[model samples]
Target: MRPFDPRLVRELPQTRAPVAALGLLGAAAGVAAIGQAFAIAWLVTALVGGGSLWAPAVTVATILAVRGILSATTEVTATWAGARVAGVLRERILGRWSRATADDRPAPERMLTISTHGASSVEPYVARYLPALVAAAVVPPLAIVTLLVVDWSSALIVVATVPLLPVFAALIGRHTQEATQRRWATQTRLAGHFLDVMRGLPTLVSYGRAEKQADQVAAVGDRHRIATVRTLKIAFLSSAALELLATISVAIVAVWTGMRLAWGNLDLQVALTAILLAPEAYWPIRRVGQEFHAAADGAEAIDALLADVPPACFAGRESMSVRDLSYRYPGANVDVLQGISYAVRPGLTVVTGPSGCGKTTLLELLAGLRTPTAGAAEVPRTHLVTQTPFVLPATVADNLALGTGASPAQIAAACAATGLDRVIAGLPDGTATLLGDNGFGLSAGQRARLGLTRAMLSDAAVVLLDEPTAHLDPASARQVRSVIRDLARTRPVVAVTHDPELAALADAQWPLTERVPA
Candidate 1:
């Protein structure tokens, strides 16, 4: 997208308030700036024509002061508005991301970069570039007309060279965009690599290969640094070139004014006013060029993120159905389950399978985390309990409630159903005890029981359990099985297990085996 594209600006929702404020501020600033210019011209004319300068001096100072105040206020308001807009956009991006595919996550990091650094950098552009550009557009024409009234030759010189500034700015912008894209790509690759390394640091250290991996990280960082330097160099060069163009244009206008002054075609007051206004005409273009580069990084970041998560139509309230379901790992020759068929009713169902026989895959399929490549699987609302339960770093009660706003009675009922009543009773602070990371302070059986309790507390109609008793002792496992069997009386329970006690407790059992493709 073009750096100054209106569509890109419109994509940000927060731009509306600032744009409106900018229009008002621009008008005020333009009038003030032009008023100050006119006052100076009048004062010069008065002094040269042998008239009083008091009135012109007062007008110039008052207008200049008001312009400064407006400029500061506009900067503050525009910064606040831009921050709000960027925050809203970032939230929307994340909300959309929750539904994105695994492949879509990495690219969305670009959106984060834009929302943070890009949004912050663009504030100056809005407060300064936009208002200045407006002033440049309006004030110059008005100033030129005033100069024409005094002397047509100076006005002609001002109009002739003003267009050069924007032309040069556009040329510089084209080069900057390419350089920024390259730099952004390098940063994204580095982030992905760094995240991967952090996630696998434990394994790398255990294998005594952490030092080798550190070298790889350093190499990635070096490449990122080089790309960053290249981007900065291009930006610096472009700014310098644009600045030079504006300066040269102003100089040419100055020389013409000097010639006119020497000839008697222009008075001293008219000549000075025109010279002062000459740089003002190019100032907006120079500011625009600078702001464009700053905002370009954010624009590029948004583009990369949006590319990953293209607008998608959500399947609204559609019930899931599966039948004769089977799945095999990619590149694996054997099916995880052969001819597995089941209709899951709306209630608790325990799923049991032999070790490494696709039990977790089946639960993932049921929970809509994975799609089966073979057969049909039908499910409505689902909650899955794995052998090792995940307890977020939070209070025990919060973990059990899982944000459902379940009443104390309901929470206790769930605990009882998961055979956790005794466990909670034993705690010094029942339901409020802090479970550290991974519930490390709790025993394996306690964690498993808590996982089951959490799943039970959910409002989901169907619940799948994969070896819920895997970590429990024989007595605790028997108690859990009994509790589960009691739960199945009202809900469809599908438990996948090789445990004979659990199998006998289940209403039905379906054996799973790897099947070769025909």
Candidate 2:
């Protein structure tokens, strides 16, 4: 992606209000800066000419106060805009990933980097670089235009040299683009490696290979440092070169003003204003160039994120619909669930099949979590209790709240219905116990009951269960089956279970078969 991608700017229409406000604040600050320049110039002229200095001093102080307020506002607004844009992008990225199949998503390590660290990098880009960009757009032109009106000769000198900064920076950038790309790739790989090694440290230690890999880790770390330093070196060199060019440009204007002032060809106040404004014109541009290099990674990351998340489509409102459904996994030779047609209403629909008949995939399709390869499916809002349901590290209330909103009584009722009331009651704080990681203290049966309880509490019209009874004993399974029976009374329920007891209660039973290759 281009370092200053306009699409990224476009992607942030939601952030336009704050960005626009920041720009306005920046423009106001620039105007105040110009006013300060004139005030200082007038003070110098008055002091030298033995005139009254009170008015110029007061003007200078007033401009300084306004500029200070503007600067603080710009900083706070920029910080807010940065955080808001990053959060918006992350939410969209995660939403897309959640709606997509695993095959469509980036690898875990890369996704984590983009969503966490990659998202964080945007803060500096938006806060520092964006504000600099606004200043560059506003201040330099304003300074040059003001200079043009005050002293055309100095303005001409300032204008002649400012373009050289960007041209020189671009030249340096072209020379280092390849090296920078390589550095970024290496940095990503090393970062992923560090995360991977740390996550697998226990496994490596168990195999007596943890210590041996320390050398590899150190080697990768050293390479990353070297590459990062090399990139920073290039960046610093470009900044220095731009600075030198800007300094020379300002000096040229200064020399012109100085000679004119010495020869008595220009007024003292005008000459001082020209000198003051010349540096402002050049430095804003140079600052932008410097910040662009610092913000390149975040810009590219945002571009990648925007590319990855396509526009969303709303789910249909049907209770259930399937016609000639077929699914062939990526690179597969044949469909897994081929030419299957089924429609279900608000009742118990038990689906039974041999181990490899794509029963779970069918449920996923109904839940709108996967698309059929060559069929039509319409399902309303759905809740799927997977074979291994998600159990988070949070309080029981928090975990249950992950489902549809319910009062304490409603939650307790759902728990009792799903045979989880006893587990909650036994906890130190009923419904408030913090399950460390994945309900760490809970048994498999308890997790199963919890999953079912949440599903029962969901407002979805369709609830798909994938082997929800697998982890339970006979008594618990019977209790859960009773809960499923009650859930079916309100909405459509399709459960994939090997338990004959659940199968017997089904109002309609679906027997699935694997698709055979032609």
Candidate 3:
């Protein structure tokens, strides 16, 4: 976006090491290549004049072997650097959004693009484009300098023509940038549309609309194909033009060197070496042009991600307090939550509410997951058990111990307290059992209890539970309510539920209605 974004170095400090390594390796490799060009010329000259060739041949082989090793190293390091850079960028993005409210993050479709395929595309830019950039920087200057010392006539021709590569590339980009941007926008939308539709296909089928979208999908696919082909055609033509320019430039140098050789102004070795070194100056710049065309999408993605900077949050307190706070969604005319005052200390506070009255919003506010609109919240480190808790396709132990340093004994103790120990014991592998998303093979009650178990193991000063016993039977509900009581004895506990049994045991109960609020 900014040609070469300086913020990439400022923001992602981890990338500096690999990029510097590439630059250094490129310089070293360019030096070796220059030496190898002379060695190759000397070998050819020896063969032509019937001179002894062993020394020059060995020199050429050794330089080539060194270059080969450097090439392999460059390849591996570039790959590692690409994946590493992409990984760090993705981590920063996901971590930022994980701590942000719904108002701050992009839609799910765009977020999916940023975290997955978008991150994947950056690998090519780093592995290919960056190396080419280093080569274009190091090889061309070094080659031109070597040519100047060997013969200024060849150097002058190279210096004069190399500028045309970037100039031609710039002209091509200026002509196509608008179309490229439009096509890329359409490409992103089409891809996101297909993915979103696939994810919601079941819902669409239930609503009798799935079959209707097939023609739309086909139409979008065709449009994407046409746009992609057009973009590729421009890209290929631009690259071809640069290649042709480079070839003609190199030919000019070769013909000048040959003319000087025939006139006895230059020896065969210098003439041959000048021709070999001349091409290196042009190709690195040309390769850079090709890679830039290929990597523009990744560059744009990086720009998009870096522009979204997340804020820092500190732990406020180990209690819940909100005084006359009101919150509205961004760009909304009405408030999702009106002026409300609530406070909680070290005890059980049960909030009962009907649907869509900002119950979960209040809990999120208390957990420091969202900021207040017009007031302050003195909420502390909190462990919240949402109605639908996070479930990973990992072993049971991994799920329970996620984001906590709880040991096995502590995990088992918490599980026992929540009556989930029996569920884990009944499984074939106990705490090692593998689960699918949302805990497949486990009932909703078990999932809820597992979530409760995880919450119980948390070290947070406050615990927030959302319908912890919604899926459980009477007996299991009683067991969980007992665990809730046990949890309330030591720390501040906020439970959002409709169960009378749990409410009866609460130290406080606030109903969410027009007359009263929590």
State which candidate has the highest lDDT.
3
Worst 10 residues of 1 by lDDT: 310-319
Which TM-score value belongs to model 2? 0.88
Q: lDDT per residue, candidate 1, 376-465, as tens digits?
A: 666665666777778878778878877467899998888887778888888878878877887866788999899877766776656678
Cα-lDDT of candidate 3: 0.84
Q: How many residue pairs clash in each candidate?
A: 19, 0, 0
Of the candidates numbered 1 and 2, which has the greater TM-score value? 2
Report the C-alpha lDDT of model 3 over 1-35, residue by residue, as the tens digit: 43466777788999899778877888888889889
Arranged by TM-score with the best first, the candidates are 3, 2, 1
Which residue pairs show backbone clashes in model 2? Answer: none
What TM-score against the true fold does each predicted structure earn? 0.79, 0.88, 0.92
The worst-scoring run of ten residues by lDDT in candidate 2 lies at 307-316
* Best-fitting candidate, scored by TM-score: 3
Model 3, residue 329: C-alpha shift (Å): 1.7
